[model samples]
Target: MIGVLVTFTQTDKFDRSTLAKIAGELRGPFEGMAGLRFKSFMLDEDGVQARNFYMWDDDEKGRSFFTEELVDKVTGIYGVPPKIEYLDIVGFVDNSGT
Candidate 1:
């Protein structure tokens, strides 16, 4: 599997309601996305950063999802451009059963 981390950072912090709205807005695009395994949304302790962690079956699809228009949309929403990173998943530990 391939993992992608996209972080939106800003000098000013966002309130919880705004974050919730952003998260809500995020859900629609991935509804029928191909090669998607899962996506998790995250927030920094300082509330100045928000992140999306995505797992995908196809690296190309995952990497190419962030098109210029999409980036512009995110930038328009959060008022900050995102920093994206791709990772190779070596292993995963699931403790949900425990």
Candidate 2:
């Protein structure tokens, strides 16, 4: 399994509502992606962040997902470009309501 995590933080001029619509637009294509195993998103007001956690079976597919089409799909919705930070996770847990 391969995991990719991304963090999006707004600039001094952006708002959360605007960011959320950009995120919502991504759900359909990402969920339908060939090698994507799991995808989840979350917002943290106190942290002032938006996070995405995705798992893919193939690394290439993961790396190539941010195509111009997807970028347009998101950037077109966003009021401004977001600052994105990519990541690799060493560990995690589902918690499963336990």
Candidate 3:
């Protein structure tokens, strides 16, 4: 599986509204994509940090969505640029989407 950790430092002017917009956008559709096998998200005000935690079925699926509208929505809302890192999910918790 392909696990990608998408991280960013929020701009000084970042607001809750923008985070809300991001959540809305990510939960929607684009580029014929449908699902994220597994996902999580986190934000740290003290560090001005935000991350998009994801685990897709494979590299192709992951890259396909990243190159699609999801990337645009992230860039549009974050104000500043972001960085991404790829990793392997050696272990994870799954509750059948509970």
Candidate 4:
């Protein structure tokens, strides 16, 4: 498994309602994507940044997803270029159902 983190710096702060709407709008694009295990969208408390954390079955797929075109699309939506980082998944702990 691999973990891909893409962070976007914000040009302005968004209110809670606006942020929820943005997250809703962005969710459709990621549905049923190939090689994607799952994704979590996040925002900082100060609302100065947004991030997408993607878990991938393959590292190459994760790397390929962050193309120039994707960057352009994210910039178009958020008004800032994204910084992408890929990392190996050393371990995972999931106990949500417990």
Return the top candidate by lDDT: 1
Give candidate 2's error at residue 97 in angstroms.
12
lDDT of 1 by residue, 27-53 (tens): 997877889988888889999988889
Measured with C-alpha atoms, the lDDT of residue 82 in candidate 2 is 42
- TM-scores for all candidates: the values are 0.86, 0.59, 0.70, 0.86
Instruction: Write one digit per residue (lDDT tens) for candidate 2, span 16-95.
Output: 67556766776787667789878887667564666677776777777687667765654555433444434555566767
Task: Please write out the lDDT profile of model 3 over residues 1-98, one tens digit for every residue.
Answer: 77988887855635656676777776655323445676766676664777778788777777666664766767777765667778876777778769
Runs in model 1 lying further than 4 Å from the true structure: 94-98
Question: Quick one: ranking by lDDT, best first?
Answer: 1, 4, 3, 2
Off by over 4 Å in 2: 12-26, 83-98
> What is the lDDT of every predicted structure here?
0.86, 0.64, 0.70, 0.85
Model 1: how far is 22 from its true place, Å? 1.8
lDDT of 3: 0.70
Report the CA-based lDDT of candidate 4 relative to the real structure.
Answer: 0.85
Considering lDDT, which of the candidate structures 3 and 4 is the better prediction for this target? 4
